[model samples]
Structures are given as C-alpha cells and as structure tokens.
Target: MNDTYKMMIVDDEFEIREGLNSFYWERFQFQVVGLAANGKQALDLMQRSDVDIVLTDIKMPIMDGIELSRAISVHYPHVKIVILSGYKEFSYARDALQAGVSEYLLKPVDLKHLGESMMKLKHLLDTERQSSQKLQSYENQLANSLPAARDHFFQSLLEDLLPEYHEAKEKMSLLEIEMNATYYCCAAVKIQWRDQPDGSLTDANKLAKATTIIERHLEASQCHSYTLKRKAGELAIFLNLNATTVSPRKSLSLLFDHIIVAIEGELGGRSIIGLGEVYQSLLSFPDSYKQARSIMERHIFRERSGLFQWDPADSLHMERKEYPYSVETKLLDAVLEGNSGNSTMYFQHFWDSCGLDSEHAELPLVLRYLTPLFTMLERRLDLHGASFETMANLHMPFTEYVEQFQTLSQLKIALDRLISDITLHIRKLNDVVQTTSHSAVQQVKKYIEEHSSEKITLNQMADLVYLNPSYFSIQFKKETGINFIDYLKYCRMEKAKELLRRIDLKVYEIGELVGYQDRKYFATTFKSYTKLTPLEYRQSFITY
Candidate 1:
C-alpha cells in the first residue's frame, strides 16, 4: 500500500459501502479511516483523524455530499475528494465540480479506474509537497548563509568563472539572478534628500520602489541589464553593456557609450560616473573597477556633471606612477617614533619628491600627487590601531577620503588637516609609549591572543595598552621569551591546529578564523607549523 494517501468513505447504502471497503482495500492500496453514513459523520471523523482523500455518496440522510464538498473546499483545500453517485445526475456532478471535487465516480464504481485515479492524485500530491518543502529549505539556507553567498559571488567574479557571454547568462540563471551583458562596470551613487521629505518617501519600501522604477525605465528604454545593491547609504550598480549581436569590438564600445549617457541622464546629473574599462573575463573586473573609481576620484575638481571613462581612448590619459618604497620606510619610522615634528617634515619632503610632471593640469595632477600620500598616511594610522571613533575624535577623515573633496586644493587642505590631527595623536601616543609598564606588556599579549584571527600590528597592540611601541617591545620579550610578532604568530598557529580537527568547516573558513588574512599565506604557514596541509591534518583526525 502506498503511504501517500489516506481515504475516507461516506455512503448511506450498506452494500455499496461494504463492497468498496472490502474489495478495494488491498488492490487500490488506500487505508480507510472509517466509513460514515452521512456528511456530518464524515466531517467529524476527518477532524479527529488524518485523511488525504475522501469518497462520499451524493444523497445522504443527515447532510448531502454537495454541502460536505463546500465545507472541505473551504477548510481543507489540500485534502482531495471524489463524489460517488447513482443515476446520471448532471446537477450533482456540476455542483461537486464547482466545489473543487477531485473526481466523480458512479455508484457501482469501476474499481480499476478508481485505482488509476488514486495513483495519479497520490503522485501529484507528493510532488507538490516535496516542491514546497524544497523551497522552504532553500529559504532557510539562504537566510543562514547570506554573507558566505556574497563572498562566493565576489570570489567567482574575481576568479574569472564568467568568461564567455553564454557562461555568464547560464551562471546567473542558476542562481535565480540576471545581469545586463558582459564588459561590466560599477558606479557609486550618493543620494541626499532635502529635509527628509515626508514619511511616505523616507521609508525603506519607498526607496526600494524608486530603485525599481529606475531599473525598469533604464532596461525598457535602453535594453540594458543591471543589478543594484545598496552599501553604506550609497547605491552601487554592477552594470553590463547592452547591444545586439554584431561586431564584437564595435558592439562593446557602442554599448558602453550608451550606458554612460543613459545612467547619467536618468540621475539628472546628480551623480558622477566612474567608467571602468572593458574586460573579456570577470576576474579582471576588480582591476578595471579600481581604475574607474580612481578616475572618478582624481578628477573631482572638474565640472560635477562631467563624465569620465577609464578607457584611455575616451579621454585624457595618465600613466600610473609608483612611489619609492624608501619614502614609505622613512615615514613609517618617524610615525612609530612618535616624533610628530619629524613626521610632518618627512611628509613635506615626500610631497616634493613626487615627480609627477603632467600636462592635463588641474584636479587630475593634484589628485595623482595626493593619492600615494593618502595611502601611506592611512597605513600609518591603521598600523597604530586607529578606529573610526579615533579619526572622528581627531576631527579629521583619513587623507584618502574622496567623498567630499571636489578639487586638488581641497584635497590638500583635507590632508593638511589630517596631518595636524595625526601629529597631535602621535604626541599623545609617544607620551604613553615612553612611560610603558610591565602590566601594560602583559595586557598587549592578552589582547593579541584574544584577537589572533584579526589583522594586528605591533603599534596597534601597544596602543591598546597605552604604551610606547619601542619600550613595549623590550618588556614583551622580557615577559614572553619571544618578540611580540613571533608570539602573535605562534598563538595563531596553535589556534589553527585546534581548528584543523573540525572536519565540517572548509580550509578557507578555518584560515580566516586564524590570524592570516591571505589564504595562500595561511596555507603555507599551516603546512610549515604542522608538516601537513590543512586537509591532510583534518583527514588524519577522522576516525570513523
């Protein structure tokens, strides 16, 4: 007997009811809950027991089958019903059909046809139940692993999995997603509301509606495809170029030009576009993305409505310059020593040393010169374990902040302000360092062990305990037998070994849990620490 169906028989005739219960029991494989003489008894039994299907005679004493069908249709639409009748009563058949009856069987019901109908209904019911369960399971999984899914998608893009046009289309469909076309680009859009409008326009739903409207109009009018995601109160578009199948080069170039006009025109010149270069492979997208953002950032002093393209052929081209590592080394030393005076002096020298002799004079050149400086200064602050709170407290944004600065001169002023704030911070940091204590050294060690998985530096650890790095290092070796950096690495390797025993987690997840930020580097370190690869280590511990 198939476990898929439970049947209930409702009939007033004793002979017909008895015959159906006995003859069809073994052949049709349906388990009868109990036989009822009328609709009232059938409904009562159904409420008390589990029934998947019901067979009811049309004419009964207490209540009729039509009334029962209507009640079941409303209360349990999921439970299927087959009406049993004698005579060719068209009215009864129509009433049953209207009430969502599964089938109508004649009173000397054909056992063979009844068996076939039950089998078909059973298969359909099982299929629909499984489909619903599968959907619920998928939604649960998605809710639990949203972060991992985001990482996987980004990693796929970075790994060049989407190379050909067809491959990209197929991949998106499998994920229940769609994108525009190949040759992707990204632009950050910042929307500032005037006085927050009214309640109607300020809610999340309203913003979502606006986004939908924009996407629909863009796609319908221009035949472009795009995915929009919100991050940090800014809207970012992962856009694909759109064009009919034609000359590859011409199609791509023309599509990009149209994208630039369509996107800017829709925003009514309220946004700046950072046009990334076209790439044959998705893996190269990040590189192109960097260019687009840099291009947009570097030309901030120009007209706000101005459109810039990363492709060299579209506009003025500038070659990327590499700053000397020696300059970085010198700046790092001054910052570490907490000598704000020397740090300021070295930064000025670093600026003078930048040999950027460009002809397209104005915002571009200024941005170029400051880009490297901003990076170096940011690194220094990061090395010191500075938080966003610290930056705000200092009344300065990091020198690399590109959001508000419009001109090269404005950037210079921002940087100058940052330098002043950094100098004050340095003096405060240096004072704490010079007066380091043994307890402070112990505190640093404890902090390192606790946060081994996170990115950490010597200066940052020292800052936590309010100690000078130079003096702190001396005391740390005195207390722990090894240098601060060595101790931190040792702690990380120990944690990795413990994690290696847990076979459920992937190697990458384990590596992320450790102090190592670079996966390759973590793998190498794990192998060095325990003469086995992470996978091999996990395999050894598997007993069953």
Candidate 2:
C-alpha cells in the first residue's frame, strides 16, 4: 500500500555518489536506497531491490550512463533514469536521450537544478507507484466481481420502478423468480454514526470505519432479499418486505436498535433511521426512494441515532414552509448587520407568511427560493467563470439557521444577524455588477417570475431586459443555474403547488392558470415537480 519512491545513484567517485545521495535525500525529499561505484553493480542492486529511480554518471568501467539507461529502459520500464555527464558533449546528451534517460545534468551541476531534477524524478516515481498499487487493488477486487456484480444487478432490479420480470429472470437465473408474489414491501436499515462529544463528525476515516462495521453486520445476516446501498453519506439496506416470512417493522426494529446500540457502543458518532412505507411491486420503488430520502432528511429532528417507522401520520408534521423573498432579503440583510432584532423580525414574518401550520413543511421551498437568488448573484459576479469561492463571500446559511435555530424568538434574532451580513456583501456585489453588467439579471428574473404563468416569449423577455436574445439566454441560464425554459417551468410548478393546495379548482383549471393548456401535460409536469400525480396530490388532501 505504501508507494513512495526508492532511488539509486551510481558513479565512479564515492564523494559524487555520497553527495548525490545525501543532497537528494535532504534537499529534494528522495530516499537514496542504494549506491554503487559502477553500472554493473548498480544494475545488480536494482534487479534485486524495488527501485523507482536511477541516477548514473557517464563513463564507468563496465557500463556507462548511456548503457545503464538502456538497460533500465528495457528491464524496468517503470524506473526513471537520469544521466549525469562530466563532459558537455552533444554526442553524450544525444545518446542519453536515445537511451530513454528521463533527464540530463552536466557535471558540476547547480544544486538547485539537481534538486529540481530530483523533484521531477520523485513525482514520476510516486505516480508510477500509485498506478501500480491501484491496478493491483483493482485486480484483487475483481476476484469478487461475480458476486458483487450479482448483488449490484439484484439491487438495480429491486430499485427499478418498471422491472420486466421475465427479462430479469433471464439475466439473473439465480433469482428464482416468484411471479405470483405481487405484494412487495420494503424495509430500509439506515446506518448513521453517533455524534461526537466535540459536536462534529470531521474525522471522515472514522465515520467510514463505523459505516463499514454496520454494513458487515448486515452482510452476515440471513436476509436473502437485502442489499446495501450507500448514498449521500448514509448507508441504506433495502429489503423485500414479505409479511409471510418476516414482519417488515420487526425486521427494521431489530436492525435499527441493534445497529444504533452498536454504533453508540463502538463508534462515537450519532445514528438514526426511518423505515419506508410498505410499497407494492417493483414498479413503486421510486416511492421507496422518496420515503428513504424524506426520512433521512428529517434525521436532524430525530436526534441523530434512532429507529423510526414509516407513518403517514408524521407526513403532516414534516415539511418546513418557505421563507418569503422580501423577508429572506431582510433576514439576509440582518445577518450582514450582525444585528439580532431585524433578523428576528424578518425570520418570524417569513415563517408566518409561509403559514406552515396549514401545510407540509419543506426545505426545498426555502432552499429553492434562496439558492436561485444566490445563484443569480453568483451569475452577476462574472469573475471570468470563477468559482463560488472566487465570487463575493456572501452566504446567508439559511438552511443551517432553519435546521439548528432553536426557538422562534432565538431564530428571529439569528435570522436578522444572518440577513444583515448577507445584504452588506450583496450590496457590495451589486455595486460591482452596476459597473459591469448593470445587474441586468435582477430585472430579468423579476420579469420572468412575475410572468412565469403568462405566455411570454424569450425574445420579449430579452427585449424587456435590454439584452440580445442569444446573450440573454446564455447569461440567464448561467445566472439562475437553469435555462429560461427550465426556470419558467420551475416557477410555474411552484405556483401550481399553491393552486393544488386550494381545493376549489380542477387539475385542468390549475394547469391553465399556470400557463399550461393541456391537463395531461400538467399532470406530467406536476409529477415531475412533486413525485405525485396531480390526482394523487388532490387525493392526498381529500378529507372525505
């Protein structure tokens, strides 16, 4: 696993070899593994030892630098050879280059140049070593490729919303398909690390070790249909929830409790899990994924490591409503000011404006509302396609505030401080933009959002924003993190959420209101947004 280089130096003069060994060892950060007085001796040592680099002087008794270089090029193609010539002869340099010498240095070489050459050789050695190690590791992993591939294939099949049973059986003969068994329930085991007493899981290696330990336990279990999948820093065990053989809840409980206790007892990191709803057939796997993601997202509320069952009853309890744009702006401004009062006022107003008391709470609503604005700012910066870091260091951290902020009163104070700081930085960036693009995007976004539900064309939008259509389209997409069409679709979809919540209208009517004339197209669009069909969404709210 260790792949740092071991270099060998050969020369007729002992002082020369010693100087190179010591100088390269200390100054250039290379290990002088071997030294020889002649090329034959050096070749002998190199053949026996795991050498990555070779340095040899020209004009030796048995083998000169050119001959040695040729031998190394032929025998150890991975080894990098450096030629040291006392005479500044073109013939010697040409022969050295022909023999595949990696570098050439004249006698009485500057220590600086020697150190630089050694550094280059060291890089080559390290790169070769890493490549060799990775190739070997890949080969070793390939030994278990059949079973790993089988597991992956099964997992894919289980995860597919529309798995063709016959095709699956043909591809995987070992599955032994039971066609009559249509009711498929899913059990998910979420493995999480316990929180540290220091309040941060900064040690990534330690967290990975904990996850590995939990995954090993599941692998040893007799759950035939179980497959482990890791995503977004969480481990998920997908199980076929068959009521006949085992109860999904009981199975989930045993795994969660066992794993949670184990993680707490062994690793010092927080752990929590939420079981998904029992869905029928492979076609409903998307539902299972949503369930898992939804559950995991709420792990912050579950207090780290805890077992949770899928209960639609908690559906109403989830979802944090979006903070209004003006309030968010004010909150961003408050954070910039480092003031608690204004931030609190904005934060409270945002939540109250959202009216989460009557609807499902969501982070997406807030993140979607805020991320776009930030992205717009980032777009406005135009730091020659510089990264977010290169752009103004203005960040509101609304998600953090929403998640960790305790009391409504405390959140308001924190919100104001957050808003103030953000607004200050935003103002500075706005000034920067005025000198450049005049924040053409700001006016463009306002127009787009205002007319998202209207039949507005790109040309019209471009003209309104006072930019060429082509350039505006490019800049708009770059600024908003989405194309104009996509942005419009997103805005309309968001508007549709409000319309859907109001039980007064039909799906088609809402579609037209959102600028979609076709009801079928609207249903598809709504599904794309909420993962629920328009009818299904309406049914979710039906009290009768």
Candidate 3:
C-alpha cells in the first residue's frame, strides 16, 4: 500500500500517451490518475488532483514540455517529472533537465528504466509523507495543549467532580478543544517505579523525558486528543473520535495500540495504560475517567503491567472477601423478580448473616461487602443517570455516619438507612431505565430507518444509546419482540420493498440503496423475510 504512487502522462501524440498508459502502471506500484494531451492540460490536472509524478513529451502544441516542467518546478515542486523527447536535440533535453525534471527518457521510453526510476521515486515519496505527518502531528499537539490548563480541566472532567457542566464547556473552549466529537474515551498511563528510591532530581528528569516521549507518540495518533497529569500520578490522554462519526469505540483499539507501541519502543517507561469506556456526553467523561483510574488502581494492587482496560470486574476485585452469598443471592432474586414484599426481608437476613452482630461490626469491612454487592445488584436492576462521582460522595456520608454510631442499635439503624438509600436509588434508576430504554430502542429503530443507505450494526446502535452491546441486544429484542440483527434486516427489507415501488430502480440498485452490497445475499434475505425474490416482491407490489 505504501509503495503505491499516483502518476500522470502528458503528450500531444496520442500514441506516446497511450503507449505510456499501456505499460501496467500498477505493476510498478503506480496509478495513472490522469492522461493529458498538452502541458497546459497536464498542469491543470496536476493542480486539481494529487499527481505525484508527471511523465510528459518535450514538444507539445499548447505548452512545451520545458515550460510545463519549469512551471511545475516553481509551483508543484514536490511532484516528480519525467521528460520524454523524440527530438535528438540535446539542448531540449538539457533545458528540461535544468527545469528539475526527474528523468529524460528517449523517444521510445524504456519500460525497464522507467520502472526503476518510479520504484526509487515511490520510496522517496513514502519517506517524505511519513516525516511530514510526524512533524504535523507534533506541531498540532504542541499548539493545542498547555500543561497547567489542560491538566486542571481534564482532571476535573474525568474525575466527574466539576461543579458545573457549563464551566467545563467554558474551560474546554478556553483550551481550544473542539466539542464537536461524537464520542470520547480516556487512556491513563500509571507510572510504577522500581523499589529503588531514586534521587528526586533523577526521577524528575526521567519523568519529564518520558512525558516528552509520550506526547511525541500521542501526536502520531490520528485522533483529536488532550493530555493531563492526573492526581493519581498517571498521565491521562482523552481521545476524541474525529475520522468517523460512527463511534470512537470502533477505532479505539487501534489508537490504543498506537500509543502502547510508541511508548514501549521510545520511552522505555514502566507504565500500564488503563483504557476507559467510550462516553457520549461531557458529564459522562468523568465516569469513564474514573473507570480508567479504577482499572489503573487494579494494576497497582495486582502488581501487573501493560494496558488494562476498564471492566466492571475491576470493581469486584475483592473476590476473596467473604460474605453471605446465599442470602445475597436470595435478596438479588427477590429484587429482580420485583417481589418487594420479600426483598427487604431477604436483605435483612443477608445483613444479619454477615457475622457483624452490629456490636463487632468493622465499618471498613462492612463497606467492602456492601460496595461491590450494591454495584452487583444495581447492574441487575439496570441503573442509569448516576455517575461514579455521586457514588464516591457516598464515602464521606458513609464514613461520618459510621462515627456517629457508637452502639449496636445505632449501627443497625445507620445500616438500615444506608441500605434503604441504596435500594431507593436503585428502584428510581430501574424506573428510568424502563421508560428511557423503550424510547431509546424506538430512537434506534428510527435511526435505522434514516440510515438505511449506510451500514448499521448492533454495536453502533448500542453506542448510540450508551448501553452495553450484549445488554442492548437483549433489551432491544425484549422491547421490540425481534432480535437486533433480524430487526435490521427487516428494516432493510422494508426499505428495499419501498424502493422497488419505483419504476426507475432495478432490483440490484434497490439492494445497494438498502445497505446490501451483495445482490445475491440481498435477494436471499428479502425472500427469506417476504417470501419472494426482489423482482417477485416488486411485481407483487405492482399488482396493487
């Protein structure tokens, strides 16, 4: 792919132009984008398209090869030019060569020699393009970010602790971050140093160097990004999906790989990156950020290295923490079944079974059981509209109330209230998910209708609603009474049936318009759904 270069052939003689074009350009890793009869035509085409190399005859009616070569040399200097001359005039050859033409071929150009020159020119172009892209990437990164401002804003953004979203927007504007991206995700690199307590000066110097290398690598990443030094002592890069409007998640892995490869090869820094989930809204970025941080915290505790992506499992790392699972499971089953009558009874039983006996209760140990358990139950409840920041805020109240409870009775009361508060939040979120998920599913149905001409996938629609793809797949089926893929195919078939109503559209054309590139596959799908081939379906409709 890198070896491929675009070229143009220009000459007054059709034979010469046709002859050059006849020789397989693709064989030499070249593509002929244009063929011009005169120098003026060639120059015009060169100006319009990216013609990397131009092969032209020395004599032409409109503009002589010498004049065209000189004009190209002055204006489109990056373009390589090869002069072809039937005239034995050494002066014409010398003049063309002086105009910075790459090569001077005789009247009957040798394909062998031309191929060799093209191979060399192709290598040069590839090298130059890579260098230019790197330089541009570095310049763009430098121009967009400042240490203090970027850090403060992103730290506040990802921690999801910003006081006001409007303030965040203002800060982002001030930082020149375009808020036009469809989705965003955070990548956090947690630096874990060796046991050796190096000198402060030495550590600082290496840190600065590592950061510089990181920024250099980040610049090469083909996505809009912002960097920050997090309070957790990690370098955070917020990635904005720019190339496509589909989803950041689709390209995230590739970009993450780019970051990992660059740092490993260049920085030699001891770090593991935590890849956060994709977020749609600005407020949600903090939750995603927290997710990244939480994953990084796992890296610290597990004493593991490399890139670890955020998963719900990270929050449940205390697998060995003993708790009354039977009672907990009974409580969960009651809640999920919406047996509100038995739910509280089951929850109380679980609390009692924890061996806390109120008086001997260690608050910290109690929370370790409660925290992940609450999250586990909440997942089953399908909670939404709550950020991790809000959950973290629970820590202060939880700790304060624990201090206020001096007796077993007081501790039990506090525990009941806490449980009640958590359950209430869960129920409220469940109600919201029930109502909103229906509307969101409908919204996806409508979106599929609108984007019938383009590719539509379950993951793309899941990203649209910010739901886990598997969960959304299930919910979509439960709500609409059709599996997502089947629903999409049905939608496409419906659109195809409508398109078939048009006398101007052929069956194959209708297939393409309805997001099916393979006509045979479309026909099979259409027949499977509607019990008729596309033509038969159209004819049946025409009978109406």
Best by lDDT: 3
Candidate order by lDDT, highest to lowest?
A: 3, 1, 2
TM-score of 3: 0.31
Off by over 4 Å in 3: 1-147, 163-167, 193-201, 231-233, 243-247, 301-304, 313-544
Q: What are the lDDT figures for the candidates, one per model? A: 0.61, 0.60, 0.67
Q: List the residue pairs that clash in candidate 3.
A: none
* Candidate 2 ranges beyond 4 A from true positions: 1-3, 130-142, 150-544
lDDT of 2 at 299: 70
Model 1 agreement with the true structure over 240-295: per-residue lDDT tens digits: 55444674345534544554454445432234445566544433455555666677
Candidate 1: count of backbone clashes, pairs at least 3 residues apart or interchain: 3
Against the true structure, what is each candidate's TM-score? 0.32, 0.29, 0.31
For candidate 3, lDDT tens digit of each residue in 81-186? 9887888887887898899988888866677877787777777778888986775576446444545666777776664454333234434533435444566778
What's the residue-level lDDT of 452 in candidate 1? 68
- Residue-wise C-alpha lDDT for candidate 2, range 440-482, written one tens digit per residue: 7778778766765455566677678666544455456557876
CA displacement after TM-score superposition, residue 162 of candidate 2 (Å)? 21
Ranking by TM-score: 1, 3, 2
- Residue pairs with colliding backbones in model 1 are 180-225, 433-467, 433-468
